[model samples]
Target: MRGELTAKGRATRQRIIEGAAAVLRERGAALATLDDIMARTGTSKGQLFHYFPAGKDELLVAVAQFEADQVLEDQQPYLGCLDSWEAWQQWRDVVIERYEAQGDECPLGSLFFQIGRSTPGTRAIVIELLRQWQESLAAGVRALQGAGLVPADVDADIRAAALLAAIQGGVSILLSTGRSTHLRAALDQGIADLRGTSHAAV
Candidate 1:
């Protein structure tokens, strides 16, 4: 559907999605209505349907994608460059800060729940988001290896997968308990273990 949009149409559609994302975050996915989104985006019903023919569900999926992208975007330069211990620490801090600020309200998670995670579009979005996130983590591990911070024999992919899992676990706990304690421990220990690998090899 997006593939067929003109530049202006794309921009308008994106505007609607972003506005809808904000509304979802503020009102929760289950409670938000198309009228709320239309008002927020200054769009009419016709305009909204023109972009998202499937109505609220379709818009929610688009908002979900936006939130998913934001999860990575919030990590910034630190996530992109983990060549040094300093960079890794920075990334850790940013990750902690982002989640803590967000508290227990996960817009992406809520959107998926409302849309049904089994839905093909929602499932693909989640899978792609995790794939990209894990790939970035793996690249960071490789960066550390290239810089001689981690031993060459260490499996970057496995290390990255573990770290990603730990982060997700911590996030799950946070969403359940509204505490960052587990998240902090997970990140601190994950990085510490990675650092330990270098010493272990020595």
Candidate 2:
């Protein structure tokens, strides 16, 4: 049941979620418990339950959304304005740096795994995030086309989809192997494919 929360109440609720995410990132979601979030946020059970009455599962979903926001947030400036090859490269590096720093601990992935990927709500969050991501990438490709850097018929959406899929796969491998080789390869291949289309158009 949603309450008409005061400003402070809203802030406290957000704090709880952020604190819980930190706990998840530091110690796997499997191990981080309600008391852990309580201690981390300095909140008592009464307040915690007031916000997340559904308990761990509900809180975990909120944290997943938070992490997903961060994934895009961290790539901003570069990701938001990819009008040229250089801009795209900057965005690519930003993504690489963010994921590299994260190492094998993908907070969003952890949330998905924790809740089971097939859960309708959780799966929708993932799909929506990917949709927005691909749209931005496709827009960047379209920008290149406008600037004569890529062919007019480059099928930006399809290209962006493939590139995004490759990046996700590369990140998976990076997590498994603790190496950046696959990430680099995926970005390189994606860029090269775009460049080829540009040359073909010329």
Instruction: Give RMSD to native, each candidate.
Output: 0.9, 1.3
**lDDT (C-alpha) at residue 90 in model 1:** 96
Over 2-26, each residue of candidate 2 has an lDDT whose tens digit, in order, gives 5688888889989999999999998
Worst 10 residues of 1 by lDDT: 55-64
Task: Give the range of the ten consecutive residues with the poorest summed lDDT in model 2.
Answer: 193-202
What TM-score goes with each of the models?
A: 0.98, 0.96
Model 1: per-residue Cα lDDT at residue 162: 90
Q: Which candidate wins on lDDT?
A: 1
Q: What does candidate 1's lDDT look like per residue over 1-202, in tens digits?
A: 7799999999999999999998989999999998898899999999999999998888888888899999999998888888999999999999999999989988888999999989999999999999999999999999999999899999989988899999999998999999999999999999999999988878
User: Candidate 1, after superposition: displacement of residue 66 in Å?
Assistant: 0.7
**TM-score attained by model 2:** 0.96
lDDT measured at residue 5 in model 2 versus the true structure, 0 to 100: 83
